[model samples]
Target: MWPEGIGTGAGSLPGADPREAAALVTGETPEFPALPELPHRSVGADMIGRTAGLLVDLAVEVVPTGWRVTPRTGRDLRRARDLMSADLDAFDDACDRTRPGWVKIAVAGPWTLAASVELASGHRVLTDHGAVREFAASLAEGLREHVAEVAERTGARVVVQLDEPGLPAVIAGSLPTASGYGTVRAVRAPDAQDTLRELIAGIDAPVVVHCCADVPPIRLLAGAGAAAVGIDATRPAFTGATARVEALDAIGETWDSGVPLLLGLLPGTAPRREPAIADLARTGYDLADRLGFDRRRLARLAVPTPACGLAGATPDWARRALALSRELGKAFADPDEVPAGGAGPA
Candidate 1:
């Protein structure tokens, strides 16, 4: 699974430079570096496009609205493959010096992919149960090959992070149809969990299920065999009196089970006034106290990160955020070592 006191990104950085992104992430979060996803690079580099390119037999092409299934491999699919290959090369080159023991790579989870991609009929793939199953199987096969290649290239154990930012919308039936006139039918929780569990079981590596939504399905993901669950602890839906009791209970139970949490506490974008590492880490510290866990338990159960992806951040803020995240990781492991007032502005 995950190492104690580790920090990493939620994927997607600000720039289009793969080499730079790889180097920055490896340098900043060496203990648990993640493969940088640069959506700014264009269609192929985006979360959906990148993951779509990994499909075994399925092919997707970009339409005016978005990506849709195609009968055959198209130029869009080819370009996506090219971008992903170049990124892998960049990651390999960047890690040549550090050779981190563990590396993370993210892909769109099955549910999100289904909800986002459209079939030939202009309906979401999730609308067809058979198609959904087929896509999941293809994705699983693709991921296995992708993992093997990455492990071979970097000589490190690969950690698969399944990004499910769309799962909440899918479960709530809030995702608009292609026509935008109606919503897709809500998916049953049990069905979603089963699909996710099968996908996780298919992959060989330890899986981390990430969902930055206001109300991430923590209980379902945890039960589906995620080695770790990623969420934004600072999200309004997860904190204070406004937070849902079910969400709070799920988080507390997740920790009580000894499953590490990739807790997002720092701002992903630039703040008006730069805060100290101590200031940024307070959310996590306070979360531990409120949950009735000893502060030291954070060292074992929490890994600090930005609230979400840094794609919208300025280049400088992105780098600073990663550095601060690393610092917070160290602080989690040794709170006494942090300065009294706070470390200066990152």
Candidate 2:
């Protein structure tokens, strides 16, 4: 379902020009490319805004509280759709000259989307069972059409990366109500997994679920039928010397089960100087060693990505970070590329 290189975890350069961002994505990550998400542009291009564009017959408008469902279309909703459309146009043109082999597109997953958007009554959509099912169905339908359109224009196999950054909060019931007096009920693991399964069903594209949270449900995501689970590998859960047994167990189990892990190894910020590719790639190498997988297995099972979105990075840093990541991908392919002694040779 993926190739061996670094791909953007969906969001790109710090500007409003979707074309420049999209074009940079195409130019930088040749191993695999993704549709650049330009959330820095404004409200509409953010994760929630982009996913809102895909809601069928449902409209979400920005309010003082956040995204709220509306009975009729509104300016906020229109802006979201317009920015999304412009992104598509920019992406189409970016890929026009030389069609890509594969392109990953990101949208908020069912649980995250439900948790983020509010209903007409000012409560989260996830609070209502019927609304949850409805929104998932609408998202599934809308995604199918969106993927088809992207495939038509870019001539690349479209891979969907469902960003579930809010899933942990949803499962923990940490999200406060609009009034901030109480919290929403925590969703059971089974219910959350099943809901996600329904959202991805029949979508007809390989799917990757990205959760950069401290406690992303690795096994649950696999059970939900995600082809790959993107995680923040730099987090203590995965990297600390005494990283919790649960994290180790999950990593071992997921890989042993033949599921790929989209490892987030790059920092999404500007370092004083550009780091060496091997220096940047050491985490993946060490991870493979820790998990007892052969060095070569890293290339086969791991897809490198930024620790999170690059929206906060300067434009120069964004491009450089991606370029360095592509090199990390190459290093994954050639074990000797990292040198035997230490993080790449001096």
User: What are the per-residue Cα lDDT tens digits for candidate 1 across 1-346?
Assistant: 5577778887789989899999999999998889999998878888999999999999999998789999999999999999999999999998888989999999999999999899999999989999999999999999999999999999899999999999999999998887889999999999999999999998999999999988899999998988889998778877767777788889899998877788887777898878887776666777887789887878788888887899999999899888888888888888777666565335
Candidate 2 shows a clash count of 0
Model 2 Cα displacement at 30 (Å)? 2.6
Candidate 1 stretches greater than 4 Å from native: 340-346
RMSD of 2: 2.0
- Please write out the lDDT profile of model 2 over residues 1-346, one tens digit for every residue: 6666445554455778988887888888754778888887888888998898888988888988889888888888889889988988988898886577888899999999999999989889989999999999989999999999999988899999999999999999899987799999999999999988877776899888889998678999988888888898888888748577788778889999988888887777876656676665677888888889998878877877887889889888788777776777778888786754444322
TM-score, each model?
0.96, 0.95
Looking at candidate 1, what is the lDDT of residue 81? 94
Whole-structure CA lDDT of model 2:
0.83
Q: Weakest 10 consecutive residues, lDDT, candidate 2?
A: 337-346
